[model samples]
Target: MSTVLETRNLTKSFGEVKAAKSLNVGIGKGEVVGVIGSNGAGKTTFINMVTGYLAPTEGDILFDGQSVVGRLPRDITRLGMARSFQVAQLFPKFTVLDNVIAALVAAEGTKASFFGPFTTAARRKKAEAVLEEFGVANYSRSLVSTVPQGARKLVDIAMALISNPSMLLLDEPTSGVSIEEKFPLMDTVMNAVKKHGVTVLFVEHDMEIVARYVSRILAFYSGEIISDGPPQEVLRDPKVQELVIGHHLDISILGDAT
Candidate 1:
């Protein structure tokens, strides 16, 4: 795996508060990396800078060996990267099918073309296939407002996938999803990413999910990476154990493995 993304001494500040403090990390292609941090640890800020949503106060971000410092988010996406939000963003009034179709339509460049003839019929069919792949085929005709939060998240991710991104940045994919539906949701995401060779970098608080899904974990504390390694190593670290993993995993979850 080659380095697909890298940050050099990345720093950010808002007014008098420091959000990120001289951080550095490298992410390889096809790797699923987890970022765990408490509130105000600058996790979102870090994502923003990487996605070109916010310019860093200092340091640099390189994607695919090129600087992405001053580009816009859309510009970044056009370069084969897409990001999903913590709270799934969807056009509530639109039917699930339309929301996805809209993304497919938008990808072809016109928003109000209503005629649906921007791309070849083959491409439109491809978008519909993606929706079916995520198990949203049944909700295709339903309104986003009518669907459950988990389904909305699924649809949102499906829309992002329709773009065929090489790297996916997910803020919190399982946020509103029910516990029972989680594994299936994760299965869909991981399967799609792996089959497509899409790299993933996400922020999540759930230790179990990180352990099961990501190959590496990056622990952020007060705007800095305190630990980075395999799940067992990072979670068992005294530093991470005291901070992020404290409440989530007790003696029971970690057990004699300690």
Candidate 2:
């Protein structure tokens, strides 16, 4: 249970708006953590900063005990961190397999040579394996634009994982997926992460999914973490219930359902 990621006084601001305020947290290797918040609560800001998509205004980020401040996203990926976006980041015109091949090429730092001999037998094998792993093998030959959103989300995560990252951040993995498909999508994702032993930190809006999939929960309100602990404890907290989970829905129903 060693700390694989840590943030100290992590702060981000845009003009007068504070997106994240003095955030401090540590994530352990192989742990599955969920982040929950309403709009503008700084959940995405934390992910962006940790994954190097956005630089913090001030404070520090350490991955595996080394400072990663000011590092580019690609450099951070090379350091064994990878992320899937809330909106699936895919080349819509590319075939599902080709998209993964492109990711494989980029992960190899050969983006310039991507079109040339990049889809060799070995690379193709790897890409196919990734597609199968994410349960998107059936869509391998289809254009990304033609696939369902759930399949596209799987493809995006597959591409991120093809790099063999030790830690993975998923922004709303179940977003845009049908209610019936959410559990299956998460099952596929969680199974894949377990197979690779990758630490996971995901931002999700659905309390049921978060409670089912994550070992720990971090509740955010007004750009600060208001609760952090086990699912039952955090979800049942008065502040979390009022500010994040709310009393409108019977949380007990969610607990039983999950």
Candidate 3:
């Protein structure tokens, strides 16, 4: 249960608006935690800060027992932390295999060889292997824009995981996926991450998805965490029910799911 990630009084503000306020939490090694909230509830803001996409206005972020306060996103990734966005981050015009190869280059921190021979046979084999691992090998030769949303998501996550990070943060992992595709998408992701023994923190609006995958939940409102604990406990809390879940989820059914 050693902590892999921690935030101490973390705060982020844009002008007079405070997007995240005095946040504090600890995620242990190999824990799969879910972050839930209404729109603009600071979930993404917290993710951005932790991943170094946005620097905190005050306080600190510690990853693997060291302060990462002023580090850049690439530096954080190199330190064994990686994240996938709410929107799949991929090159639309590139084939899935090529995109993965590009990600591999970035993960290796090698200078891009734009003028000549960027994709070596070794790189292609590795990229194909990663694509196969993520269950997106069928789309390897397809342009990313032509692939289904679920497959695109898998590729984006595959790119993030190419560096073999110890901790993986996913922002709205199932967003834009159809109802029929959600469970299968998450199943693939959870299985792959579990195989890698990576700690996971994901932001999601789908209650069913959250209830099914996460061992613990953090509910946010007005830029603050109102409840944090096991899914059963957090989902049943009066404050969390009113502010976060609202009419979207029926808590009684979720008792057995978590």
Candidate 4:
């Protein structure tokens, strides 16, 4: 229950628009906090600032009680915080084993030694273990092109997990996967992350996913947090209902089955 991440008066602005406004939030080790907000609610902006993709206009971010305001994304990651992109980032032509080895190499400051002994038995064993946890070990020798989009996402999550990050920042982890695949994928993720005792902060659109996975919810609207509490309370909040959840859950998507 120790504090893992904390933000104080966090703010981010792009010219006339303020994407995140005076945000203050805290997450503890092993906590899973869900972020729900409309498209322009600054959920992504908040994440960008925390993960070092964007600098805060004012205020500070503390990771494990240390200031991290001016650090770069890679530096932030090296310090045990890893981020997952909304779109799956993978090398389509590379073998699954190679893709993971590449991440390990980069993590070890040997990204330049692609074909070197960097992919030694030890690294391969580690990479293979992550793949197995994601249920994609069978596809280790397969090229990325041959895998399904859902599996690709699992791979992306596995890649992030391989870094052994202490805190994970995921932007819509289940964005492109099918409804049937979502729970299983998340199960894989939850189990693996829990094994590492990592804290999670994620932006997601699905209420069902939020209820199923998150221990708490932080709802945002127009670059501000409207509610921060348990799933039931946040979902039942009037401001959250009117601004983000209600209208959003009713939207029509091509694959509404998910």
Model 2 per-residue lDDT at 2:
97
Q: Model 3: runs farther than 4 Å from truth? A: none
lDDT assessment of candidate 3: 0.92
RMSD of 3: 1.2
lDDT by residue for model 2 over 43-159, one digit each (tens)?
A: 988999999989999999999999999999998998899999999999889999999999888888875564567678988999999998888899999999999999999999999
Residues 1-258, model 3: lDDT tens digits: 899999999999999999999999999999999999999899889999999999999999999999999999999999999999999989898999999988888888988885666899999998898899888999999999999999999999999988899999999999999999999989999999999999999999988888899999999998999999998888888898888878667765686555
**Regarding lDDT, does 1 or 3 come out ahead?**
3
* TM-score on alpha carbons, each prediction: 0.92, 0.96, 0.96, 0.93
Question: Candidate 1 residues 49-79, lDDT tens each?
Answer: 9999999999999899999999988778877
Candidate 1 residue-wise lDDT at 116: 46
Instruction: Let me know the TM-score candidate 1 reaches against the reference structure.
Output: 0.92
Position 160, candidate 4: lDDT: 81
Candidate 4 lDDT, 1-258, residue by residue in tens:
799999999999899999999999999998999999989999999999999989999999999999999999888888888888899888889988888888777667665654556668899999998998889999999998798888888888888878889999888999988989998988888888888888999999988888778889899999999999988778767898798877555323212221
lDDT of each candidate versus the true structure: 0.83, 0.92, 0.92, 0.87
Instruction: After the best TM-score superposition of candidate 4, give how far the Cα of residue 143 lies from its true spot, in angstroms.
Output: 1.1
Q: Is candidate 3 or candidate 4 better by lDDT?
A: 3
Model 1 regions lying over 4 Å from their true place: 108-120, 250-258
